[model samples]
Target chain A: MAALLPITHLLWDTWRGNLTVNPLQDWTFRTGDWALRLLVASLACTPIATIFGFKQASSVRRALGLYGFGYAVVHFFIFIGVDYRFAFDLIWDDLATKRYILVGLVALLIFMPLAITSTRAWMKRLGRQWKQLHKLTYIAVPLAVVHYIWLVKADLRDPLLYATIVAVLLLLRLPWVRTQISKLKYRRVFQKL
Target chain B: MAPKKTIMKIYSSEITPEQTYYAQSQSRRQFFKTAGLVASGALLSACAPSTPSTVDPAPTAIKPEKPVTAGQTDELGDAITQYDAISNYNNFYEFTTDKQGVAQMSAGFVSSPWKVQVGGLVNNPKTFDIDDLRKIAPIERIYRMRCVEAWSMVIPWSGFTLSNLLKQVDPKSEAKYVRFETLLDSNRFPGQRDRSFPWPYTEGLRLDEAMHDLTLLATGIYGKPLLPQNGAPIRLVVPWKYGFKSIKSIVKIDLVAEQPTSLWMKSGPSEYGFYSNVNPEVSHPRWSQSSERRIGEMARRRTLLFNGYADQVASLYAGMDLRKNY
Candidate 1:
């Protein structure tokens, strides 16, 4: 958090003059994009840890999850505090009428349980069920992308790029990739079979 | 040399001693008293409510001789006043796209020294100064201005009918269209330097529409000389059209035989039509125009066709297909 100040200040100064996008919208989009990227990064950690045979990579999962939540919180606050001016009626109307808003809210709601149970105590309590519950991120991520695509009016280029990145990350989890990994395993049980 | 130096030193010492003594005695007392009085005066002024004299007076120089008639001042005076403030503070994108930026930057415009050049297909090619144009004729009409963005405002504008002004210009037999140009000054208007919009903002109307009684060459709003933000010096006010059709800070009025290209229409033809009327049924591809929030209304409300002036200006487009033209 302390290290992020300089980068945040640099972004603020750079966008002070540009009026093509409003400052609030720019901040929301950047934060939301960063959250989506962090979610993809967290998903990559499990795959990377398994491939390299490193136990240390698994420990960073909690930090990555918290970072994604932090960005989501920033994005949520910006929408409520600045964009809607904390008006409940307007927010209610947006949530009801706007498809993108509804999708985003649902994604956030799904992530809330995962984020709350990210701690070691909750993990120890839930034990086997914890991993199953955290898998909801895979669903949450695609919903987030859909929320973004529906929000944009005409420009699909940025959203398309995000979709492509997400697709590649999800493809790494396919059965073919898992089968290749199994063939390369050093365990003798495979040879006996 | 020793005698002269000693005399000069004695003179400087004498002046310093006398000044120090005065500062230590009467001057210090006087200074403290004056400071105390000033502080108390400031305290008293801060405690008092601002009276009329203390408040900045509304610009009195441009007040119209004829007061607002009873009929014109309807039950919506408060709403009209709020609309006046919003409309007068506008940065109609045609002049400059930035809403608040244009207000401050347009101060450098020399409105009084300006002239409108009327020529092209007109029988008499003549330039009229601001005063000459003001004296031609004056009419006060309250009309609703609806923006392409779906915000609306009801403004009481003081101006001569565009038809009356056109009569003075005397259109030639071949004249079929009228094009308007806003003054271009990059130094005065920083928005002019912005490439988001093309320079020398232009709008056009058909000759018949230009000559319509509802079309006005406005000089004032709320019975006062227009502020720079509201297109001071001169602006066009076409009541039935979307606000963009009413060009601002006009410098040239050209009557032409061919249809002139408008700025927005040239940029995005499908989004902005040449005949940009205030038709709620005709929605812009980007957003619905089925409703508009009046500037000061507590809640967003439905927009009226022709901005509720169908009785006055609907006949102009009676036989034509509005959807196709739109």
Candidate 2:
């Protein structure tokens, strides 16, 4: 339910005529931005659960990943469907020439299987294979960040900041780092209690 | 009206139908009615009247005419972009990098007491007041501004030709290029504080490009004094080149012996070139420039070589490799 807010806010802005002069660019950027943020947030869930010992955090990871995938689909739809008007020639030209768009497409492709197998039936069927396949989140998040950093003309602060967060979250997921931090955190919690 | 009549002679080929132009003009005026009320109210309380306005120009000088003339559109017959969109959406990186945010960030910016210094390798060096510069030969020009980011706008700008200004300060025999520098006050322009860019943003053009009659030193837009975000007081309008080549809020003009490296060229030598002419065939390093979305239009149109100004400016770059130069 909370995932609907970004699109709702965008629709309200569109209705109010409060969008930027180039509404298409605004829509594309906003949707892409939300997709990246949600995907990164999905990546951060396990790290948070391990480090802070919040067991409940892992439960929503699937939902967050699904939401991120949903936004990515809309982002691509806006680009190829609305903006390009399904002009395969122009779209093909962009895919061939534009590096950032190509990277974004690859990242979206990675998210697709993860989103499709998110159901409990599929997850249980795949079992350990599902976990290994979903590990591709680690790859998808960084590619999305690279897509952002490459697309921006000069300012890299926003994208770089996301890159740093993703780096730290990934570092925390390392077995040694996770076990050490988790032990230290639980020990401190018991002392406080 | 006399000034308007004379300026129309320059763009006598404008072929927009009379009825379509009238309907557009009527709706434009209606938009201005609401926009002007809000603008005047905000402008009155926020800033003093030191900023020159076409609303009340000196009786002796040519003032920008309104209701833009019948069939007065760009050479491509593209309808003039709405004044609100043109003013409200800007790429004045001095204030902010966000296109729509520049207007709000530049609120109450003071462009008064501005003096543009014309010197360096010139026979006659002079510093002219911004107002005096506008008086030289202010005329309205409808131009298609294509950004390197694959977006474009059709704007009606009011200013004199850069050739008129360049001629005043006669270039020395060895002067081969013209370098321009923006005002460097970090306090007024917050974006300068960021070290990512070499501030007092600098840009340059070849001497012949600077002398082209089509190149304008714009001081106003939409028949009004330029808004702060639109590079008020004075800016350059090189229609053939990408929009960034038309630098804003200029303070210094130098006729140099060598091609001066512009800020973009210094920052990304591979992406931006000295001549940043608009050519669809030569794409930017990261993005395709084969097509562009006009500000109001939804679908992308084929990007034109030299932004549809090739007829007038192509001779200037004859026998040269535009791809190499770009």
Candidate 3:
């Protein structure tokens, strides 16, 4: 429910004519920003569960990833459909020349298959290979972050802060770091007892 | 009450003759050409400094006309952007990097009784009161302002040509460039405290470019004194270049031989260059600049070369490669 709040607010504000001077740009940024934020949140779920001994956090990981993917779809659609109006010739020039555009497109392309295979049926059919395919999250998330960093003209604070959070989350995923976190959680539980 | 066939024939006769329509278009084009010549002539005359003997000698504010109606448009027939949008949507990084926040952040800023120090490689160095500066040459110009972020606005700016300001303290023969510096108060401008940006935003222009008739030292927008967020008291307005080239809230003007590295250039040398002209062909490293969404307009229009000031400024960079310069 909280994940849907951004889109809901976006729609409400847009309908009310409360967007900034440039609504299309505002929509583009808002959708893209929410997509990045949700992806980061999704990535944090597993590590958060291990570190804090909250197993429920792990359950919503798939849902969060799907929501992130949904937002990414909207962001991409806004860029090519509404904003560019399916002007593939202009978009092609953008993809060929603009580093941010290329990076963002690559990130979205990686998310497509991950989103498709997220279902239980595909997971069961793929069996052992399912986890390996999903691990592409490692590449996709960082590319998304790079896409953001590249797009901002200056004032890297917002993007860099996101990059740091992502780095910490990625570090926590390391086998050694996960073992230490689990150990710490056990120690805390034992002390409580 | 006429029969259907007769009615159709009557409607067809009412259609405008193709020849007449073509002639009307030709006359309209001719009218625009004449208007262009007249507007440029008026601008040139307005740029000449008002001598002490010919005009009001005492220091006084250069007041611009009241808010323009929707019907009043720029020479290019672009509608003047609404003052509300212009005021609220600002890119003054001194207050904040967020465009929407600058207005509120700079609410309490003090721009009155401002002093602009002019010196360096000049025959005479002096500090001018803002009122005196305004009296030098007062004119209202509607210019298309294009940002490097691929957004644009048609702004009605009121101020004097920069040439009039430089004329007071004559530049020495050796002076090759003009440098402008913004206020550096961290308390007033919260964004200054951020170490990420080198504070006291600085920008420069070649002496010739600075002296161009199109180059204005804008003091007002929409015929009202500038709001703090819009670089109150004084700001540079170079229509041919990207918005960043027009540094805001200026405190110092120095005539120097060496090219001064603008804050943008210093921060991102590879991405930003000295001459940040509005050229669609020269795309930024991060994004395409070929198209820009003018404020209030949904569809992105193809970006024009020099923001459609190519006729006046093209000769300035006749031989140089803009791609390399940019």
What DockQ does every candidate get? Answer: 0.11, 0.52, 0.61
Clashing pairs in 3: none
TM-score of each: 0.58, 0.86, 0.83
Task: Give the best candidate by TM-score.
Answer: 2
Clashes of each: 0, 0, 0
Model 2 residue B9 distance off true place after TM-score fit, in angstroms: 4.9
lDDT of each: 0.69, 0.83, 0.84
Could you tell me the lDDT of residue A39 within candidate 2? 86
Cα distance off (Å), candidate 2, residue A118: 1.7
User: Chain A TM-score per candidate?
Assistant: 0.81, 0.93, 0.94
Scored against the true structure, residue B182 in model 1 reaches a CA lDDT of: 90
Which candidate do you rate higher for lDDT, 1 or 2? Answer: 2
Q: Write the per-residue lDDT of candidate 3 for residues B1-326, one digit (tens) a residue.
A: 22332111111122222232233446755644454555555555776654334443122211111122222456667766766788899999889888999999999999888999999999999999998877764676778899988889987777888998899899999999999999999998889988889878999999999998789898977666778988998999999899999999999999999999999998999889999999888878775688888897888888889888877777889899999999
Q: Tell me the docking grade of candidate 1.
A: incorrect
Task: Give the lDDT of residue B23 in candidate 2.
Answer: 46
Alpha-carbon runs more than 4 Å astray in model 3: A183-193, B1-71
2 or 3, greater by lDDT: 3
> After superposition on all CA atoms, how large is the RMSD of candidate 2?
7.0
